[model samples]
Target: MKNHSGHDMAGHNGHGGARPGGLSVSENGYTLEFDSTIFSAGAQTVTFRVTGPDGRPVTEYTPEHEKELHLIAVRRDTAGFQHVHPVMDEKGTWSTVVTLEPGDWRFFADIHPAGHDGTMTLGIDASVAGPYDPRPIPEATGIARIGEYTVALGGELLPGEASELTLTVSRNGRPVTDLQPYLGAYGHLVALRVGDLGYLHVHPEGAPGDGSTEPGPEVTFMAAAPSGGTYRFYLDFQHNDVVRTAEFTVRTTAVPRPDTAPGTAPGHTNHHHAHH
Candidate 1:
C-alpha cells in the first residue's frame, strides 16, 4: 500500500511497518542497504530500502527532477546503462530487477527530501566479478559553440577511478558571468558514456541565493565520468528565456600513471606547454 505522501506504507517479507529514519548504503555511513546478490548473468533483481533522518519511516518526500528517486546504473566499462523505476513494496522497500551483463559497475541514487533545499546524492561502486582494468580516463572532443556557450572536453575514465572533466563556457570570446539558474542549479550537465549511453547527471558547484535577481552568460562544470569508454556530454543553460545546448565527444584512454620525480605530484597537467 502506497501512502498519500509517496512512501510505501506496508509490511512485507519479514520487514515491519513503515519506520522513521532515512536509509543509507555505506558502511560507517548511511543505513540503506544495497543488496547485490540478486544480480545475475542475464536477468537481475536488485533491492534497496530507504528511511527518514530521524529513524522513522519516510512517508512523503519531495521529488527532484520530476521523480521521487532516480537510480542510474552503468557497467564500469560503458557496457550497460539502465535508468530504472523502482517499485516501493508494501514493506517500504524499493526493488527492481534488470537484465545485465557481468562486469564492474556503478550506481547512483538521487534523492530529495521534503522541505530540503537541495537534493541528496550518493553513489556505490560494484564489480560483477570479471577481468577488468579500472584505470585510464577518456578523452572528450567535438566541442562546438552553442549560442553564448563554448564547450570543450577531454578524458578517459575507468571504473571506480574518479572521472574528472573540465568544461569551459564563454561568451563574446571572453569568460562569461551573470549566468542564470537552470534546473535548480547554476547549470545542468548530462553525460552518456558511448556504446550504451550510460547516464551521468551532474550540477554545478555554486548556485545563486534564494532572493537574488540575476542573469548569466558563461558557466563551467566539472563532472566525473562513471565508467571507461567514449562519452557524449550535453550541457544545457538558459539565457533570455531560451535554452541552449553544447555537445562534445570525448574518448577514454587506458594510460598508466607515470612515476613522477620526487616531490612531483601525479596526474598534474602543465598549461605552459600547451601555450608554447
Candidate 2:
C-alpha cells in the first residue's frame, strides 16, 4: 500500500508481529471517529464510524462472537466499565447509549471488516461534562459481587503466557446453573491494565450449545497480560433474561527480563490513574 508520497503504511510493516489493540484511535488503515467527545453526566447516545484503508466508512464487517462489533467504555479511573453492542446502518455509522459519570472515559471499538485481514480495536478519548473528581484505585481482589451474583475467580494471570481463568458465579449462596447465553456464549470477559486501560482480547474456552460446554456456575476464558501489572477484569453474564457485570481486580506475575531487574517499573503500574 502506498500514499501520494509512495511510502509504506507504518502499521503494515510486513513483519506480522502480534500486538495489542485499543490503545490508539487510529491504526493500520482503520480509525474510530465519534460524533462528539464531550458529554453531560447521565445517559447519552454515541455515534461513530469506522473508516478503513480507502478512507471511506466501513460498512462490511464479519460478525465475531455473534456481533459485528463490540464497544467497551470505562472511566479513566477504571470505573464504570461497560461492554455494549451497537447497531450499524447502511451508511456505516454505529450508535449506542452509555451512562457517564463525571470523569474522563475511553471508548474502544473492536471491529473486523468483511475483507480485512484481521480484527482491530481502535480507541478514542471522551470527556464527561462535569466536575472531574477521579476515583482512587482499589485494592486487588479475587471476589466480586454484582446485584445478586457473587463471582469467585480461580487460576493465575502471568505475563507473556496464556493463562486460564475460571470464574464461578453464584447467588444467595447457591451456585447458578442455568446461565443464559449472552453473545453466543455463557459470558464475555474483558481485561484491561489499570493505568493505560490497554485492552486485552480474551477468548472464552467454549461457546454456548457446544457439546462439552455447560451453561452455568462457571465460565472459563484465556487471557494474557501485556506486562506484569494491576489489571481490571469485567465479566458479563446473562441469567433470568437480565445481564449484569462483575468486576475483579488482579495483578500478574512479572516475566524475567535480561536488561531490567525483577522489580522494574517499565511493565508495571505505580497505582496512579494516569489520564490519557
User: Which candidate ranks first by lDDT, i.e. highest?
Assistant: 2
Candidate 1 ranges with C-alpha deviation above 4 Å:
1-30, 129-139, 143-200, 203-276
RMSD of 1: 13.3
Error of 2 at 34 (Å): 0.8
**Model 2 lDDT, residue 183, Cα:** 80
Each candidate's number of clashing pairs is: 34, 0
In model 2, the worst 10-residue window by lDDT is: 2-11
Q: Estimate TM-scores for all models.
A: 0.44, 0.85
C-alpha lDDT values of all predictions:
0.51, 0.77
Give the best candidate by TM-score. Answer: 2
Candidate 2 residue pairs that clash: none
